[model samples]
Target: EPEVTQTPSHQVTQMGQEVILRCVPISNHLYFYWYRQILGQKVEFLVSFYNNEISEKSEIFDDQFSVERPDGSNFTLKIRSTKLEDSAMYFCASSGLRSTGELFFGEGSRLTVL
Candidate 1:
């Protein structure tokens, strides 16, 4: 079975520092996305990427955050200057279509900012 893979499943970082979460989706998927869930809260969409550019981004994806597919197979999210509020379980997802298709998601990369 094909599934998404994420590195550094648990990350502990100091506030104002930088962190990068990496993911590799199923080989055949086209669209990639980053979503996050605060502890005990609903999941929120952060950004969506397609065709090597961001197709949509939420308010959470402000200037301090960035997403990139440096290699065709790896999608990464970098947080510049982390904040305490930035601590969350960040998920990477992929789909065969833009919408209406099932989104396959990696387990998550849990970030803890102190």
Candidate 2:
């Protein structure tokens, strides 16, 4: 089955540095989302995008975080500045439709800030 794939499965960066987490969601899915798990915490929603526009975003997705579908198949999340608190396993997900609430998540990109 098709699935989401993320690059740089694990990344270590210094505080104040910038990081870009990339993902290619399922080709047929219509909705994409970025979620994060801070170490042992439960998954938290960061933002949702559809049709090249942001549909909704969480408070956690503040000025520092941005999302884009730069091309047809690739979706991306960019952190303007890395912070210790930003360390987490970021997941890229997609669903065939929004009402289903069923998301297929990627392996996740682990970000570790020093």
Candidate 3:
């Protein structure tokens, strides 16, 4: 089965630096989303995209963060400036429907901000 894949499963970065987390969603899915989980916390939605435009974004997706579909297979999230609060497991997910479908997630790209 096709699955979402993320690179650099773990990353350690200093505060105030830039980071780009990469993901490749399932080939046939149309909607993609990014969620973050702070240690021992609930998963929070950051952004959702479809048809090359943002479908929805939460308050957590602020000016410092951006997402792009740079190619047919790759979706990327870029943080212009990282912060200590940014340390979390970033999950990339895809689903066939936006409202009522299960999301398939990557193992996660763990970010450690110090």
Candidate 4:
């Protein structure tokens, strides 16, 4: 099975700096999403993208956050001005199903801000 892959599995950055997390979802999947788990907390949806545009986004995906499908095959999340509270394990998921449907999750990229 083709699974999602994320780069920089773990990153440590300074506060106020910028960080870009990259992901490659299943090639045949139609819907792509980004979610984050704050350590021991539950998984939270950040944003969903489809057909080159944002389909849905949660409050967590604010002005400082952005998503892009720069090359059609890869999806990317960029966090501008990193903060201490931004540390979490970000997951990339994709599915051939609907918004409220099932999804496949990546290994996750852990972000740590100092």
Best by lDDT: 1
Q: What residue runs in model 1 are displaced by over 4 Å at the alpha carbon?
A: 97-100
C-alpha TM-score for every candidate = 0.96, 0.96, 0.96, 0.95
Q: Candidate 4's residue-wise lDDT over 1-114, tens digit each?
A: 789999989999999999999999999898999999999999999999999999999999999899999998999999999999999999999998555677999999999999
* Candidate 4 stretches greater than 4 Å from native: 97-100
Global fold similarity of model 4 (TM-score): 0.95
List the pairs of residues colliding in candidate 2: none
On TM-score, who's better, 1 or 3? Answer: 1
- Residue pair clashes in candidate 1: none
lDDT of 1 by residue, 1-114 (tens): 999999889999999999999999899888999999999999999999999999999999999999999989999999999999999999999998546679999999999999
